[model samples]
Target chain A: MPLRLACQAMGTRFELVLAGQSEDQLRAVGELALEEIQIAHGRWNAFANDSVLSHLARCAGGPPVTLDPETFDLLQTCVRVAKQSRGFFNPLLGPLLHKLGLRDETKLDPAEDLGTLLDVRGLVLDPKGHSAQLTRPGMQLDLGAIAKGAALDLAARVLVDEGVTCALLHGGTSTALALDPPPGKDAWQVVIGPEKHAPRAHLAHSALSVSAANSRRGSLPRGDHSHILDPHRSRGTRHLQAAAVVAPSAATADAWSTALVAGCLPSDPPQGLGLLTQTTSDSWLLAPGRPSCFHIEPCTTTTPPLTAAPF
Target chain B: MHDNHSSPDRRTVLMAGAGGAATQILPDFLAARPHLGADLRVGLVGVGRQGRAILAELGKFDEVTLVAYCDTDERRLGSAARRAKGAKGYATQDAMLAAHPNLDALLIATPTHLHRAPCEGGLAAAKHIYCESPLAHSIEDCRAITAAAASAGKVFQTGYQGRANPVYKLARSFVRSGAIRDVLSMSAQSNQKNSWRTPASDPVRDKALNWRLDPEVTLGLAGELGAQQFDVLHWFTSKYPVRVEASGGILAWHDGREVADTVQARLTYKDGSQLSWNATLGNTYNGTQEILMGTMGTVRLAWSHGWLFKESDAPTQGWEVYANRQQFHNDEGITLIADATKLASQGKLKKGVGLPHPGLYYGLETFFQSITQEKDVVCSAEEGLRATAIAIKVQTALTTGQAQDISEADLASK
Candidate 1:
């Protein structure tokens, strides 16, 4: 029997399913994985006054703040994704999010000028020193987009390190990672959307992350204002309804998917990642980059999908 | 300590014990003494869960530089080093001390049984030391660490966090100033719902990692969790327990572990006031807190929040009108605001209800203050030993199903 466990962290419920010979051992390792996710949440939750992210925000414009290896890597990944997505996936849009009244329940009018504080370059990261410094104060690094995926990635690593090969971990069902195929199954089938005709992504030792503009909305004047912000325009993105990405790393998939839906990246997806996007008109755009562990299959009675040119 | 039986002026008493003088807009909020002293370089020993938490809090201080971390477990050391930015990794405290002679201080978060080596080594290197609470598992090791710290002529602090917390400090003043009147009894509990087993791929490493479950060296729940809470009562009352009677069993998580998952201990002080403490790993109801029941009222202290309940017949204070009160069944608790006067004046008393940070942050701040400002250590080694001695007695009593006598000799460093 597979052992199932769940924990609430990062403002979402993270669940894990593991298949192993010993139930006791699996539970122990599974609990440890959950602990890792909680640790990640405590370290990076942007709203938490005591989180490392808040500390970094406070220390901005001062000396470079040393970060733990994991956080340092996450920040590096954020910068890389920001550059790859042409600033659509900027992590420094924390203040803008606050202005748009998307950070918490407290509502505030969205700011008109958005580009000044969204510059990813202002985040000076020292690889040799293993430190990061914000050139200006009030510059916040919001990991809302990629933090869940990073936590899932870490949890999956724990499961793998504990020699548990068959495990499925998901953060709020939006970001998921598969350690290995379950017994007698080729891959883990993950439905991308809640629709009856939604496509299924067969994940084998890979990750899947989905981002939708309509998933979360703020109390803005515009009824369709989403939590996903475009750093350049300093407003919510409405270019695409939803976007999903499949990659070897959950954080990578998460970043790329957010970028795709925000309409930040080019029409063609990255080389190693698979992309599925929904247009505002409700049409599906498929960009299966390379033959990898991630494969997509349409649901029964699902219409034909539009395919992008090979990268 | 001031008399506890007298009815002092409410605003005067609250302001005097509110950590600092009320010159700022929000006295309690600004109770955080700014680190105005010179910057200090520090290293951490035992890069485990607690060590990582310390790293996060230490990062908040601008004057402190995390220089290195030492852990026998290379995986934890490497992981912790990455989080600490440029902090070098060492396999041993000696290696870290030798590599960074300029390291001004060392924060020890190792297992209770493994504390002596790091404490002694840091002391030998003439470095300021901050060891996590319940100083050690055994009475002898606690004495040794205390004696070494005394001879080192360096700043030594134990991680009994309550003594340094602003809320606790504020609450302590109220208790000492006779706000609660003569204390009749005290009780504390710490509940966390998880199996106390750490995961490791290797069996040998797993055994080493789960030291809290090791009956020989481990102090079980009473020592590991109860000692910290017990220290709060000791600090508030400025008294010691003369004897302890405890009973516990493996009521939960009987997965081939000898350590009890639930424990109940009653400690009797010289004045015959008893402190009942319960620690459980199987349940997390009500979380963790310490309660002081007095003739006049009761004071409840959670790590982040605190409250004082006044008897209906007790003398009412002028500040009671402005204080925030929370209802608990039939009882009502007046929220113990550290700088109630300053906040009350601004009509922001509600915002100053709880601490901005955890108790650990304040303890680290105090340690840094002691190092740079030449201030007194908040929770010294001797106090840590006394707390540890009480915990040791509790553990012995629970294990043997008998009452254990705690003498002054058990807590004395000499």
Candidate 2:
């Protein structure tokens, strides 16, 4: 029997299933993976006062904050994705999100321009020193777009490094990664969403992430709007219904999926990643790049309930 | 018509403000941000879990620059060096110390039995030393390290973090001021559920990684896990236990390991006041915390959070009106917080329920403060020696299932 473990992190549930001979060993390794996720959650959560994001915010006008290799790498990836997605995957939307009622209200002055706080270039990374600094005051990093997937990727790495051959890891049910196929199965099947015609992704040594505008609605009283905002327009997208992507990296898949759904991708996504997007209410299109893993099974029966939620 | 009768008077408000200032908890660098100072070059002898944690906290201080790292494990050494940025890695403590001769301080986080060598090396290099506790696996080793530190004319701080924690410091002040009246008894526990084993690639490496399971050189759960808590109680009350009776067994992870996974020890102080300590690797109920019950009240201290529960008959202070309270069953615990005056003024007292950083951060901060500001050492080497002695006796009691009497000579460093 495959050992299963779960922990709540990043405002969602992270679960892992591992196949191994020793149950105790599997459980121990899985626990370490879960511990990694929890640590990442504590460190990356932008709202928490003790989180590293808060530390960075506190040091906005002071010296640069030295970061560990893991954190430095994560931030570097965030910046790269922000550039690649043409600012769609911005981590510096913290103050703007707060103004949009996405985060807890702070005592920020009403006259302060929220747009000035959204500049990704204001986050300076000193690669040689493995440190980072916010050049502008009041600039903060939200990291909501990719933190969960980055945590899952780290957890998956831990499981792989521990000599685990077959495992499945997911963060908030929206992003899933697989190490290898389970016994007597070709790949681990993950449904994209909770719909009869939802596409199924057969993941083997890869990851899949789904983003939907209807997943998380804005909390503001100004009618319904997606929480996944477009930095270019500073408003949530309404055209695309949902976007799902499969890639070798979970963080990359998570980032690009959000970008695609938010209409931030100028053209096609970076090569080698598969993309399946819903352009209209009933119109579904599977864009280029390795769409072999995803199947639109209309006659499928017995829903496994391993569907990804809007994240 | 409103009830102005319940409003606080001018004298009461002024006294309340004075009471917050008198605690002197707001000045620490953790609550108020730290200021820039001359850089202090530092090196670490071990790149294990604790060492990595220390390095992370050290990075928070702009004045502290990580110079080098030393570890025998190639994987850990490389990983730690990569994360440190601009720091070199060495295969031995001697190599790192010799290469970084200008280093202002050295932190040691090697295994319990392996601390003496690195400590002696750092001391010989004339570097301020911060060694993790329980100082060493043997009493003789602890004495040797302490004696070396005594003559080194350098700051030698033991990593017993309770002395440096801000919340713990605030609570200690309450105890010292007789706020809790006469102390009657104390209890502390560290409960966590894990195998206490690290996964290694091979058997040879596995033996080295699983040092906690080696009975010959390893102090059982009582010594390794309870030493810090024992030190907390000693620091708070300014007293040490003279006798310890303990019992233990391997309740979980019975994989041919002789070290106990669970232990319970009862320590008798000179005043007949006792400390009950329980530690286990099989359960994580209530996590880790210390409780001191006095004649009038009780102070419960977790690592990052602390609380003081006062008796109804206990005289309430003016600051009690401003304190943040959390209910625990039928009892109420007043949150023990640093920067109470500042937070209360901002009307953010509820946000001060716990520390903004882990206890380890304050301990490392204290080490740097001692190095740069010439501040007094928080946990001195001699104090660490005494705490280790108590822990060793408790471990012996656990092993023999008998009461072990602690002699003053056992705690002497000379």
Candidate 3:
């Protein structure tokens, strides 16, 4: 069991573990976790300003924020994964994620206009110097929410590479990834379902991720309200209990699961699957019925105030 | 690599755990395990005719200690566990591993395709992984296993013990010592009606009863017999097979097996040395021979039998065939023409002949020795991966009517 910041290796989340030679191994792994997180999360560190990617990314177009490799790699992954997933997932929602109390509490105050101009296409991918060229001037990419997943994948990879074969990476139960199946267990036993008074352990093979109204709220979605905004409505969907997604890779699972929770998607999931999803009314969908390894628990936490994620 | 190698730790686990993880790993895998000996501690996975016979042979080991027994068959697990020294039996891999944490090493007799997990899991626990043959379901699985072994720095050698035998070792030493001059093309083949079968009979029905015949299990007979044959090639040449082309069909068992009852393959190396072989489970000669053709002479070795032929310059050589493989002399009785092995320190050999021998069992001993010395096992992790790659290449060719080119890149990717 290892824990480290999964700084966008797969998606957004700091991977934390219970097993390693020490907490230092986990920390050391997190320091070098994701290629993107190195810049994206680096902003929260002592070398924040010196790292051109995150610092310049925050204030692009106004001034020619020089291109750095970190931001370059991040934008590249977003475009590639977005293309592969057919637009169901887009990192352009960073501002929207921030508004939902995800990235930073202070920046939750958008600059006058937010979603209307939010376009991932507006972010130009540059090659030579290797960095993003924000065509829309004010446009910024906030991969905080989803980057944790990419981070989980990276951290999981580190544990595997380091020699701790049986382990799980958990980011306070919100974002997580696993490396190799548990020693003798079929998969990491987890709970990703509706709340039963007490939490019970359930075993699963696929990477499991859960996002729900229990996290936070942005604006008010038509009638629903939660931290996750309806980008179009700039609000949350108080209509869902929790949306869970599983994928062979953590990034896909994290990204898709959030999309589903945000009510931005229908049931068209990915290949190699098993879905047991429930909406606000409690009516649910168990795609192809229950998976071989499935577990659910009622984990409803008051949304954490949005802040720069401590990667 | 032999499934029934003796180990004290292997025996004690049987007292508490019957058949542990092996049963649960693959519920339908089957192989006939022969009666090893007596009071044997034999926990096995894959209950095919070969696997079952292995269990019986495992019974031959002292104490009949079968710590854990796993099979795709739930019925087999229960009965085998109850029958074998009250061993703990499990139907799932987790239960088995959990039940017997001290499992010395596993006797992985699963079919050619389903051999990955047990071998990997066994090695993870630092156990003496005594797998049967062809230690992976696919090249990908084998590579993953090899990587895992390297990461863990564990002792690993597959169940290809033919070249490990003493007779083949001597043959290798002699041929390499220049007794067999500049080795050219070598042709080793098994020809019989059953060796090269007719065609498939009933594909659908066999799938339900037996999976060994299943393309998934046999991995094609090429993986089974051809796998061992390819290992012999590696032993003599110290080079990965440059390419292999194979084709076959089931003649008799076509009605019941997914895999071809008969199989044939040609392994071509960069140096122009080629080896071809055929095997069918019927009256297919049941005879095995390895011919080392060199510029100086030709050495033909039959199973347990040996012989040599020489060119004009080789007057010291006698042309005679040996009746028994063990005797010091042949029918012509001229010392069976011993080669000048005493002249050099190994690594100078050009050609060598090896067949499936108990001597291959020595590779297992070497594994334990390496473990004790904290050095690498004789058949290194990379060696196991290479052997498995060649095995997969042959299987791929048999599956697709065309030869699948396996580049080092492809092997590394797997």
Candidate 4:
């Protein structure tokens, strides 16, 4: 049986289940994983004054600020996804989010045009120098959707490096990554959504990320807006109740799920991706090279419970 | 590869000799102290730069009382005493110990040459001792102090603050847990553009303050700066060095100083694990850090931050998805074990500003706790002696231009 350990990190609960390791070894790996998550949280947190993202935001429209290789690569991925999804995965939406009163502090003027500020195209990256600069004055980077995924990826890396072959790592139950399975097991069995309404999927060496409109409670008094803002619409999008994507990486899955939920991409995603989206009419699964399947299920819950099979 | 010849019995005898005086005084000391309460009265020896820093940290603890400040320099003592307010000032360590009979502990931050006297004296007085690193300037003093501390039966902690650092603690845990697999070798470097000289109005006092430049009173870069790094290697490997080969010269700051501003040394353990270290005072290119290599992975650690780099044949670490795509040329490791700047940004500020230098607060806190709770210190006298012996041997190798074998007999001789 796998030993499960849970701890709070990245503003959410993270769980790690490991098999084929002693209790002491499991605890050590768990602690290291949690610490890595915490480190990622500190580095990428947009609201933190001393975070790398905040520093980049502050240095916008100025000289390029040097970043560590890990952060530089993460930003490079963000830029790639933003271009691929036609500005849907824009990290430079901090001003728009702040203007909508979603973020803690408003560093931008409400009267200012957010279209110019949300332009991810203006962000310049020096690959050789390992530095980045935002060409626009009001542009700010927010890695909210991707940082947790990156942190999950880091946790998985730490576990695997520690000689753990079979492990299930998750960030706030929304993004889950499965390492290699146990000695005799084919894959880690994972159930998506609620018990009666969810579909069971076997995962191995892959990650799954879920983004739902109701995942974050609306902070507005009228309950009209969500935490996930649409960069193109310059507002919150709730057209889809939920969207889930399975990819080789949690970071990729996380960004794609957010893009799908924002209605920026079609229901049919790119190749090598398994997608599931829930709408008012019906729930659909869009697997690569497979026909879309429809089902009737209630998807009103903010957070769908996830279940992992025994190791 | 060096052979393992050191026996446990020799170590026991060395420890026994070190603790002899303290054990004899323990009963009377316990009898004399009727009530051991929350408060711990501590005397400060060598209230200079590092001493004052420790004093400020000690002031933060409510359970600590800075009862006395001792320094050969009256001016520094007076300045430290002013900050301490109610604490008494003494011109000499002997006077301070003589006056402060009720002091529960002595914090020795004296010069390298001066550590042995105060440390030995404090143990003789039945007071728990916390001495700054390197143990002493010379091997003889290191042996004498180690034996005295072992004999004392009181808590005797060496000032290797990395022992109390959280990052070091996590890294050590990772190594001890066998996560890094079989150890191969280690490399460490410390680069700085520092003269290591303090200004003084009096010529004699200038020489005294600038003890680091004088070979007679200094351990050079290997002992003075490399002691903590060497101690960390030993801590992670749980083994002492069997041989040390060193070479150095006064490559910079040629102001009549006899000590080398640049030095390099290689230490070999009985287990065949080797550690290579180098430090240069002329350049600040890659400011101080250590890297431990293992069969499975590599751990790169500085004072405030650390990262884990897995080997190519090791199991796939998932972070590589993010790390491998980065634009930078350097390797992006999997786990960021400790990053003080990031932690502080997240509002986890309990550990103080995580600079490259080892924070004195945690070490001092551990010292106070050991005193009141009767617990063992994180860095014990024996551990300090081991590191010191290796450091001294490195210096000897540099002087003789040959590799020196460090045997258990060397430790047990004194």
The DockQ values of the predictions, listed in order, are 0.29, 0.41, 0.00, 0.01
List the candidates' TM-scores in order.
0.85, 0.89, 0.43, 0.51
DockQ (model 2, Cα): 0.41
Pick by TM-score: 1 or 4, better one: 1
For residues B21-92, what per-residue lDDT tens digits would candidate 4 score against the true structure?
A: 333222111111123348889999998767866764553355677898888887687667555657899988
Model 1 local distance difference test score: 0.80
C-alpha local distance difference test of each model: 0.80, 0.80, 0.51, 0.71
lDDT of 2 by residue, A158-213 (tens): 88878887888888788898888888888888886567776788898898888877
lDDT of 4: 0.71
lDDT of 1 by residue, B379-411 (tens): 899989988888899999989998988887877
Off by over 4 Å in 3: A1-311, B1-43, B56-66, B78-83, B190-209, B250-258, B315-376, B411-414
Q: What is the lDDT of residue A43 in candidate 4?
A: 70
lDDT of 3 by residue, B328-383 (tens): 25322111212212111121111112221123334444443444445445555556
Clashes of each: 6, 0, 96, 10
Q: Runs in model 1 with CA error above 4 Å?
A: A102-115, A193-197, A216-225, A230-237, A263-269, A280-283, A288-311, B1-36, B66-68, B84-88, B95-103, B178-185, B201-203, B269-273, B293-298, B307-357
Per-candidate TM-score, first chain only?
0.89, 0.91, 0.66, 0.90
In model 4 chain A, the worst 10-residue window by lDDT is A287-296
Task: Flag the better candidate by TM-score, 1 or 3.
Answer: 1
TM accuracy, model 3: 0.43
